[model samples]
Target chain A: MIDKINKISDVEWELKEGFMPNMSVPARIYISELLAQTLEEGAATQLANVATLPGILKYSLAMPDVHWGYGFPIGGVAGFDADTGIISPGGVGFDINCGVRLITTPVKASSNEMPKIKRLITELFHTVPTGVGTHAEKKLNEKELDDIMNEGAGWMVNNGYGNPHDLIRCEDNGCMKGADTAFVSKKAIARGIPQCGTLGSGNHFLEVQKTAEIMDEEAAAKFGVEKDNLCIMIHCGSRGLGHQVCTDHLKEIEAATKKYGINIPDNQLACAPIKSDEGKAYFGAMAACANYAWANRQMITHMVREVFCKIYGTEYDELKLVYDVCHNVAKFEEYEIDGRRKKVCVHRKGATRSFGPNSPDLPGDLVSVGQPVLIPGSMGTPSYLLKGTAAAMEKTFGSTCHGSGRVFSRTKAKEGMSGQEIKEDLEKRGIFVKATSNKVIAEEAPDAYKSSSEVVRVVHDAGISLKVARFEPLGVIKG
Target chain B: MSFEELDHTADYLFRCRGRSPEELFSESARAMFSIMFENNDANNVGNNGTDNGTDSGSNNCSNNGSNADSDAVRVKKEIEVESDSLSNLLIDFLSELLFVAEVDCLVLSGVKPKITGNSLKAEVFGEPFVPEKHGGGTEIKGISRSGVEIEEISEDDGIYYQAEIIFDV
Candidate 1:
């Protein structure tokens, strides 16, 4: 399989159609040689398999951080033609709208302010509930849950979580269009009500960081990022509610795959045509889940804000939302394909939306610049902040990498390391760490993941997204 | 130990051996809970009166000072997970447990499940978990389809049923 892939450039490769018998188009991957060194065999084959799906356009593309997943490889980006394409739950992933956001602060805490950094992280950890099976005591009734499903971040803002500025900074204004709770399952709704405003376990975290390096001065200035200033990065998703939504929809799509006479290589790739009832219903439910996730992050942001106020003696607006971006979602948008404008369903599973400068859907305040592309690193590493570029729109449907891909298995990590030891090691380096279990700390050890700097550099050098700034964690909290 | 840990780059998996179908199902549940409950003392220690965090200490981690025991409370819930195949049956069973844990903060202890008509019905016993008491561990999100299996394993003594499940965290 490795021999079958043809290198097109220093950072691009094409997998020919013969790589998969049913491929409608050849697959493409954008990765540097350093990253390609660690790309697993299954990840590349999965990328090729995705090209075999009906209605895949131009190519089945993956970013540098690609890794093997259930069906589609993580960091996958593919657009299906609206009139003839299909929607698959695997493409959107089980955790709908699992995403990340950044908050800039008037907090001028440098790397030297270890105590203050520790205090802020500790306060935020308590403010936002985390870990597996973790839920909030401030429960919302069914009515409020439904409202959040339908309203997204607006529900939080209306309920006084934040002002209107918070909504504008989020993708889709934190409210996905065409979202309706009617199609969302009752089970999904029940799970969502309690899980909202939580930081669920496994790779999800809230880190207190300071801007360590700025690569693009103009873009950094536009993004309100000042050198050595403190910032908060929250990485989580819609929680159990979104998980149920995907679980429920997968069954529907699986049956629809058989009824619609669609042939698939893997059951996980079960899908329905965009015009079919199953497809529309799944879209509605997925949009609602996306909306729910936006609201989830907004509520967490509100809690983190309170913690900030307490720690820095500042007000809510003093900690402004930089932007929120969803890495797992299917969006309905109009893109110019082959010189003709057409509607399409762009599935970004484990990939971030890199909306270019002046794109139609960008928030008005950000149109002149571009959407903020947040690429969070694994624990104890630097996360990158970048801007969407026109080159991305031309080559990869305005998509970019999401995070530092994994390397070591959880079992290997546990066998090789200990959470207490890792915690003490990080503390020795001036990083405060808090976690529910030492096991989690061990599993998420910085050694367990690929170097995030290597992953982010691939996209920045390829021009899919331009690097704006890089920040290193000062304190960390995780579930 | 009835179960052994398997390696996966992203998530963790457990392989279990049981003497029969009933044992296989029960052992699988036990193996999963083993991961969910990492602290044996926390599970066995009865109401230490140590004033640890309550069943819902998500917001009170700092106040608890250390990873102290939680305010434990007794509770019971009926759970049922159905599927066409025994492999899916095991996956569904674990998934249902995970769902309850997230929604109700329940830390399930025991299950005596009976299989009937492609479904398993069980009386799940546990307490509403407090991070302070339960010793917060890795939270599983869903069961993965990548490597789930159920089969018969033959030994020198006799034949036994076995199951393997990979959970996505």
Candidate 2:
């Protein structure tokens, strides 16, 4: 599979349409020669498989962090013609709208704050529910769950969990339209209610970081990030609710795939035409799961703020939300394709939108600047904050890599360092860690993933997104 | 009759084999539970102090003493899933088990599955998760149907069933 991919540029590779049978278009991958060494043949095959999906426009794309996932590669992106395209749950993933949100603090990082960092992480661990089978302090009733499914993060704001301004900072204004409670299942609701404010396990975390370097000072200023200042990054999703929704819908979509006779290389890619009843029902339910995820993050942000205020005498308003971007989701957006502006249903799995400057989807204050693309690193590694670039619009449908994709499996990562050993190593490096289990720490060791610095660089060089600032972890709380 | 781990880039992949389809399905459940929890064989640990006790430093089940109840309360849940194919039946059955584990907060073991054509019926047994004892391992977010192969192999000794399953963690 790797042999078939022809290098198009220093940061771009292409697998022509003929590389695989029935491929509607070529597969485009953004990766540097250095990063390409780690690329797996299975991931390349999956990208080719995505190209064979119906109504795929131009090319099936893979970001620098691409890896083999269920149906779509983890860092894969594909857009289908809205009128004739298909809607797939596998494309969106089980953890619908699993995303990242960054919050900037006015205070700067200092060596004296080590004790304070420890206290903050401890408080966060106790206040925010984490790990497997952990539930929130407050259980949502049926009516409340319905509202959350419809309103997204805005529901949290309405309930006094967050400020109204936070809504504007999120993609789609913290909510996706067409979300109906009628479409969501009781199993999903039951799974969601108890896990509303939770930070579920497996690669989900809340990190306290300090901006280490400012690459584009102007962009960094616009994003409310300053050199040496502390910030909080939250990574989570809709939890059990989203998982159940995808599980429930996949069965229906699988039946629909057979009914529609849509040929797919992988059963996980089972889909239905966008206009079909099964498709519409999935969109409604998916949007509701996306809303639930946004609400989950908003609630987490509120709790983080309370911890900050309790420790530093800071006000709730002091910590500002930089931006929130979904990593796993599908949304309708218009893009100029083949010189014709067309609406397409873009499915981004383990990827984020990199809408360039002047894109209408951005908030008013950010119109002059591009969208803030948050790229979180693996445990104990540096993360980058990048701004979307105009070149992304013409090439990759304004999408970019989400994070440092995994290079080692969970079992593989455990071979070297035990979670306790990794924790001690991080503490020695001035990065404090708190987690529900040592298993998570060991499994999420930095060695398990690719370098975030390298992943962001390939995209930046490819003009998908440009670096604004870099952050180093001061402390982390993992589920 | 046993399951072994396989390496994948981002998730958990394992292969299990048994003397029959029922054993194969049961072994798959055990394999999945083994991935989700660090100490799945809780009965081996003799102490009952695992019920959310003050032992915060370690998640090991105490094996020194065996109390009358062993502090671990066992519960049972039954599920029936029907599909057109045996593969779908396995996916549906495992998906149901995953849902019950998360929503009901049970770490299941001792699965007894009965299969008739494309339908599956199973009774699952486990204790409610005690974070103090059964250390939560990596969470298995979703069960993937990709590369799922259930096969029956004929050997001189007898016929055996085997399957390869991938999980999204």
Candidate 3:
């Protein structure tokens, strides 16, 4: 399968338009020669299939961490012409705005901070509900749920869960515009209401980390990273709400695909024209899910802050949100398509938007340094902090890899280690872990995923996103 | 007749087979719930190494057994759904069950699905998730339509249905 594609460069491969029939554009995959060896043929085909979508501009792109997903590859990124292109739930994924955020603290790590770290993680594990069927500490009513969908993280601030500064540090001010609650189904609301502040299971975790290394000293300082300083990272999404939204809209859009005569290569890629009624409704509902995710993360951050305050006897303000980036979800942004700037629907599935410095999309404080790209590794792996580069804008629609892509299946991982055994191994490595079950730990074993440093190296050398700092886990809480 | 886990890199994929579509659907549900509760046994209480407000290390709270305490709390729910095709009906049925599993905190079993034309009706049995009794199960995010397959293969002696499903976790 790899022989069917053309290697454009040391870090890039191209599958031309005719690789799959009806492909309107070519698929470009970014990976180092080393990482390319691990690339699945199915993922490469999925990328080519995405290129078949109508109104796809320039290229259908995949990052170094690309892996086979349902329809689009996990690290897929593509932009569609707003007036003539299409919107697809498969491209955004079921967990809308499933993303990550980094919280920096002035407290530096010490040689013997394990006891304190354990206490903090234990408290967070209890305080923040994890695992299946776990609800928030407080159940929200329909009215509050709507407010969260409409207002995003600001709803948390108004309810005293967060502050104004937290909002600005988030992408798109923690809320996507045009989120209409009317477009969101009641079933979706019911699923979301109880899970407003939860860290749901499967690949979602909260980790206490310390800066292990810093490469871009200036950029690291600007992002509030100090070598050896304690930082908390939270990875999760909109919980059940986002899942329901995707499920509900996919049915509608599937019908719309038939009505509009849109021929899709895969059922999951069923989509509607960007201007159609179904398309508009999906975007509105999807944005609402995205807001819920932002609100969910904000609440989790608040809980992390409370945990720190209790442990260190410090103020809540001591833990500051460095930045938050969405790995899934579609956004309407202007980019130079042909010669002039035009608005296109940019869909990022398991991919991070790596907006370069000086772009107006970034927050004012981040304008000089570029957006913070948090690439979380699997359990016990080293994660890197990277900054978006200008080359990303010129080539890959300002997007980059999300994390170390999985190489082994969960079954294979579990076959090698039990959750208890994995926990003991990490503990021996000086990383404390609190998880809902031993099964998830086994499935998420570090060996199950590709090397984080290798994936980062590919993107860094490809000039999509450059490495800024590296973090090693001190303690992790998973559900 | 039963379900088995299939290899998928990112999510849960399973292949289930039965003599008919109804059995295939039921087996599919069983497959999903089995994978979910793979690590969990009723005896594994207080599994998170933290005080989860539940009693720890008590064998009496096992929800899967004939214990009167757990049997008395068993909840039976009736599910009715319709779709455009059998394949879609399968997705809808499993998805509705998943919703119940998450929203109502039920570990469902005994999925007796009755399919007629592109519609399905079923009665399922489960009990409220008692952290002390059920411990932990994999939280499936949603059921995906990708790579979904439902086919009837004929043998020399009999005909059986086979289905493939992938769950986003």
**For each predicted model, how many residue pairs clash, with residues at least 3 apart or on different chains?**
3, 2, 1
Please identify model 3 stretches exceeding 4 Å from their true place: B39-72
* Better-scoring candidate (lDDT), 1 or 3: 3
Interface RMSD, model 2, angstroms: 5.0
DockQ of each: 0.42, 0.41, 0.39
Clashes of 2: 2
Shift in Å, residue A305, candidate 3: 0.5
How would the candidate models be sorted by DockQ, starting from the highest? Answer: 1, 2, 3
Weakest 10 consecutive residues of candidate 3 chain B by summed lDDT: B53-62
Q: What are the clashing pairs of model 3?
A: B1-B17
> Whole-model lDDT, candidate 2?
0.87
Tens-place lDDT per residue, model 1, B1-169, is 2778887666667888888777788777777776775542335634643322222326532332433444455677888888877877777787787777556666677777888867989877776655555666776656765456778878899988887677666
Q: In terms of lDDT, which candidate is stronger, 1 or 2?
A: 2
* lDDT by residue (tens digit), candidate 2, A64-87: 999989888999999999999998
Q: lDDT tens string, model 3, B40-105?
A: 322332233233322211111223444323333656899999998899899988889988877776
Error of 2 at A60 (Å): 0.2
Q: By how many angstroms RMSD does model 2 differ from the true structure? A: 3.1
As for DockQ, the candidate ahead, 2 or 3, is 2
